[model samples]
Target: MSRPVDRESPDRLYTITSGRSRGGDEVFDAVTLVVAECDPTPGMQSEHSRILRMCQRPMAVVEVSARLGLPVNVVRILLTDLLDAGRITARHPTAVNSAVSPFASPDVLEKVLVALQKL
Candidate 1:
């Protein structure tokens, strides 16, 4: 008898990630953004190639996980491989004026204050 096919089988995931559970030294979260640094090469792993194609433009890690129908952790492992190969780059999202503070900009705070006063 033949074994049933399952896309998310543990064996499949394990094989894809080379039996590793954790990614490289770099930390990758769901909202982290990734971009392809170069085109996919022949004989590259299918998942890696697909990731490269998807990341032609900056794409969030969560979006990639959803699109590929894979768990976030699995995607992170794959991204780490590409990152190590220098085929992709990853970055966490940041606010426009993050250097100043976590609070909203002065203009936005003023608007909110005026609206509250009206109420």
Candidate 2:
């Protein structure tokens, strides 16, 4: 069943005309229906791609924002969508280990400092 467009949501359904009849008397056209559900806004694809590139490891929202050079709010919105879609997973260090703070690991801290130096 087809429905009217929703103004608030990014999901959209549409039909495309595939081809025409050879005789061309009463043109026969094939209707291809598509249903896409996601943030279809401009630059969303690039944002998703960037997230996928970095999402292999658990990253904070601020880290993603800094890496992508995008505003924190924009990164939050995209992260929310990606999380809802199961494309990415969000993990908190505290959630994983109560005693281990972000700076508790000397090795990890050193690696992060080295990475920052390259930037």
How much lDDT does candidate 1 score?
A: 0.89
Q: Counting only residues 3 or more apart in sequence or on different chains, how many pairs clash (N, Cα, C under 3 Å) in candidate 1?
A: 0
Worst 10 residues of 2 by lDDT: 12-21
lDDT of each: 0.89, 0.49
Determine the C-alpha RMSD for candidate 2 after optimal superposition of all C-alphas: 18.7
Error of 1 at 53 (Å): 0.1
**Model 1 lDDT tens row, 1-119:** 99876758899999999999988436788889999999999999999999999999999999999988888889999999999889999998985775576466777789889999999
**Which residue pairs show collisions in model 1?**
none
Q: What is the RMSD, in Å, between candidate 1 and the native fold over all Cα?
A: 3.7
- Per-candidate TM vs. native? 0.77, 0.42
Error of 1 at 38 (Å): 0.7
Task: Summarize candidate 2's per-residue lDDT along 43-116 as a digit string, tens digits.
Answer: 55666767777656555666666777654554555555565666655544433453567666778789999999
